[model samples]
Target: MPLCRLAGAGALTLLLLSSTVYAQSSTATGVSRAANPALSANVLYLVGKATRHDALDEPDERHAADADEHGAESPGARVQEFELRMTSFVDPHVKADLTLATHGVSETELEEAFVTTVGLPSNLALKAGKFLGSFGKHNPLHTHRYPFIERPMAHETLFGEEGLNEVGAEVSWLAPTDWYTEIVAGVYNGDNPALFSGEAEEDVAFLGRVRSLVDLNDATTFEVGASGLTGRHEELSARSNVVGADATLKWLPLEAQRHKALTLQIEYLRGDVGGATRHGGQVVARVRVTRRWWVQGSGDWLAGDDPTVRRVRGLIAYVPTEFQALRLQYGATFSGDEDTDHRVALQYNFTIGSHPAHAY
Candidate 1:
C-alpha cells in the first residue's frame, strides 16, 4: 500500500477503536467510563516564508542538523505536527500515558510512553519507559507547546530536533524545605545519535536535575533549575557531558490574573563532547496584553567550536479559547559572517477530546 494511504488507514482505525471503547464503556451498566483512558489529539498547521530557500541545505555544520526537523524552512504550508495522546491511571498507585506523533506525512513515531508511580514512600516517585528527559525547560516541551514557531538555534544544534528523549527509568524526590524543591535522576540506554550511541552493552546515559520554586510575593513567583547528563559518544568512542541552568520569573496581578501577566525565562547549556566544547543560551519574554491576546520576544546566542550564531524573534498570538490559537511570528538569523536570513510564519493550533493541562 502507498505510504499516505497506510498512514490514513492507521489513523482511522485508531479513531474507530477509541470511539467503540468509549461507547461501550458509557452504555454498560457495570462498566465505569472512568476506567477507560482519556484520549486527545492536537494538531498544528503552519504557513511560512523565508528569504533563504537553501538555508537548511547550507554546508555549515550549524545548519545541517536542522534540515529535516522544521517545515518552516521549506517556504510552504504544511501540517507541522499531529499528535494523539492517551492517559489513564492503571491502578490506585500508578498512572500511564502514551503519545503518538507524526510530522508532515512522515511515519508515526512513539513520542512518549511512560508509567509513573503515584504514592510512594518518603515523597518519592518512580517512572519507567520511553520519555523526554528533564534536561532543561525547553527540551521536554512538545512542539505544539512551544512559545515560538520553532525551537531555539541552541537547542536544535545541541539536542537535535526531538531533544533528549530516551528509554529510561527515573526517580524523583520532593525535598523537605521551606520552598518547593525537587530532585530527579535517571538512567537510559545511550541511543540518541546526537549525543550518544549504545554500541557496547555497557554504554548508558545518566541524568540528574534539581529544581526549586519560591513565591516572591502575592502575584509573583521565581523558579530555578540545574540539569546534567553524561553518556558515551558514538564516533569518538568516549564520554560526553552536558550541563544546563535555567531561571524563570512570572508576574500576575491578583486582580487580573488572566488578562495581564509577564513572564521572563533564561536558560544556558554547555556540552563537552570528545574534548570539544560548545555553549549557548536563550532568553524569552512573554506578556499577556488582554484576555485573548499575547506578545512574546526572544533572543538566542551560541558560540564555541561551531561558528557563532544569533537569532531574534517576535510573536503575536490570539487565543480565543483554551482549545484553539492563532499566531504570527517573524525571526532574523545571523550566523558568523553569512548574510542575515529572515523568516515569517503563521500558525494555527487546535485540540480535541479530554486533554490534561500542561505543567507549570
Candidate 2:
C-alpha cells in the first residue's frame, strides 16, 4: 500500500486505541472538577535593529537570497508571539496538552495538541496527535522557553522555522538498567516544508532517539543523546535523512540553590538532501551572575553546498521573577565572503497563570 494510506491507517488505529484507554481509565478513577484542563498564557515582545550586507564582491541583490533565513525580519519592532497553553489529566491512564500561538495579529496556529498515556504497562508511554517530533534537544522547546532571541543556524536551515512540528505519534520506553536512560520512536505526517513536503497523508516520516543522564556528583551532572529522522522529500522527489548528537554538562553550588549555576550545551546535526550533505551545530553556555541576573553566549556554524555561515551571540538578562524577564542580545554573522550581518535585539516576556513543567 502507499505510504500515505499506511499513515492514515496508523493514525486512525492510534486514535481509537487512545479513546478506549481514556474510557477505561476514567471509569477506574472518578473525575472531579480538578480534572478539567488548566489554562496558562504567555506573551513575548521583541524590538531589534539589524543590517545585512551581501558578499562585498558578489552581485548585490535587494535581499540576501538564502532559504534558511526565514524569520522575523531585522530593523523593526514587532509583537514576537503570544502563546496559550492548556493541560490536564484525563484519567488515571492519560493526560492531554494543547498549545496555541499567534504572531502579531496573524492567524493563530495550533502549536501542539497531544494525548499522552499515563499508566501504561511496564515503563512504556505513548503520545499521539499534532505535536513536535522528538528529533533533538531543541526541536520540542516552545519559543518562550528559548534562551536566545532566534533559533540556531543549524535548526533553521535543517528543520525549518517551526522545528519539526507535525501530526505524529511517539512511543518511549525507560531502560531497565543504569542511570536515567530512555529510548523513543515516532512516526509523523511528512508535512515540513524545509525537509519533508508530502502532499498526501501517505507521506510519512520516522524518528528515533536515545537519551541518558548521569549525576557526576551532588554539584555536577552530565547528559548525552543521539537522534535520527528520515522521510521522503517530496519537493525533490528524493529521500532526506538527518542525524544529530547532543551533550550537556551542568554545575550548581548546592542542591537547593537555584541562583548560582552554570551549564554548557552542544549539539551537532547532519542532513542528507538528495545526493548532497549539509551539517552544523551550536554550543551555548549560561551562568547565573546574581539572584536576578544571568549571562549567556553561543556560537553557531553551518557547512554545506551553500556558503558557510558562522554566528556569535552574547546576551544579558534580568529575571526579576519566574513570571517575567527582560533581555538584551547582540549577534553578528559572517557568511563566506559576504559582509557581516549585525543585530541588536531587546526582548521582554511575561506569563500569567500556572505553567507546567517541560519535558525532560
Candidate 3:
C-alpha cells in the first residue's frame, strides 16, 4: 500500500479503538464527566503550553553539549517558532494525543506529526507512532512542567538521538503502592541524532525508568526515582548510561497564611562507553513564600570520571500563578583545549486551554 494510505489507515484504526474503549469505561463507572451527548463526545481533556528560551552566549559544545554554537555574536540569529499539542478522550478509558511543533529552522524543515491512543487494563498502556522514549521524568513531561526553566548540563548528550522524538512503543505500569509509583519502558527506531523521525538507527535500545513519590508527613515529603538504558549506533556501539537516582525532600512550616515549602532535590548519574562517559550531579532548592508565588535556584556540575570534560549550570524560576511562570538559565563548560563559552536563556510559560494537573 502507498505510504500516505498506510499512515491514514493507522490513524483511523487508533481513533476507532479509542472511541470503543472510552464508552466501555464510562458506562461501567457511571462517571458524569459530561452532561449531554455533545459534552460526552467531547469528554476528552486538552492542554496547551507556551515557552521562550534565549541562549545567552555563543553556542559552545564544550560546556553545554547542546549549545555547540553558544557564544556566537548573534545567538538569536536563528528563527523562532511555535508548538501546539492536543489530547482528547475518545471514551472514558482511552485518550488520543497529537503534537505539531516547529520552530526557528527553515519552513522546509518543519516536523511531521504523530497521534497515539492509550488503552487501560492491567494498568498497562500501549503507545505507537512517534513520541519520545521515556528516559527521565522530564523526558515525557512538557517543558512547561519542568521545575526549572532548562535542563541540566548532561541533558543534551543523552536526552535524544539528536534531541527530539522518535517512533516507538511504550508500556507503563503503576505499582500498587501507598505512594505513587510509575514505570515506563520502551524501544524506538533510534534514528540518528538529526531528523526527528524514521524507521532505522541500525539497532534498537532497551530503556526503563521507575519513579516514586513518598509523603512523609503533612509538612514533609520526599520523591525518589531511577532509570536504566542501553543502545547501539555506528562507531558508538554498546552505549549506555546506567544507574541514575534522584531524590527530593521538603520541609514545610505552616503558620497563619504565611507559609514556606523549602525543598532540596539532588540527582546523580554515572556511566561511559565508546568514548562517552556521562557522570554528573545537580542540587536544587525551591522556596515558596505565598500560595501563588515561589522562588527557585539550582546549580549543577558534571564530569565523566575521565575528567576531560566539566560542565556547570545555574537555573532560576519565578511562578506568579498556577498557569504562568518566568524562568532564566546560564551555563558554561570546560572541554580539554576547547573554548569556554557561556549560555543564557529566558522563558515564559502558561497554559492556554486546560485545567491544572495533580497540583491543582
For TM-score, the strongest prediction is: 1
**Candidate 3 lDDT for residue 64:** 42
Model 2: per-residue lDDT, tens digit, 130-234? 998887788888898886888887887778766799898999999998789999999999898778753565789999999998999988889999999999988
Better of 1 and 2 by lDDT: 1
TM-score of each: 0.87, 0.84, 0.66
Model 1 RMSD to the real structure? 9.2
Give candidates' CA RMSD values in order. Answer: 9.2, 13.8, 12.7
lDDT tens digits, residues 1-360, model 1?
A: 699999999999999988887677546547675578999999999898888765432323554545556543576889989999999999899999999998776757999999999989999999999998989899989888998988776677567656788888999999999999999999998777667743456678999999999999999999999999999897787788999999999999999977998999999999877787888889999999999999999998878876888889999999998899999999898888888889888999999999568666
- What is each predicted model's overall lDDT from 0 to 1? 0.85, 0.83, 0.56
Q: Kindly list the per-residue Cα lDDT of model 3 for residues 101-201, writing each as its tens digit.
A: 43333232223334444657687776766775565544455445556644555554444323435666778888887888899887766663422122444
Error of 3 at 314 (Å): 5.0
TM-score winner between candidates 1 and 3:
1
TM-score of 2: 0.84
Global fold similarity of model 1 (TM-score):
0.87
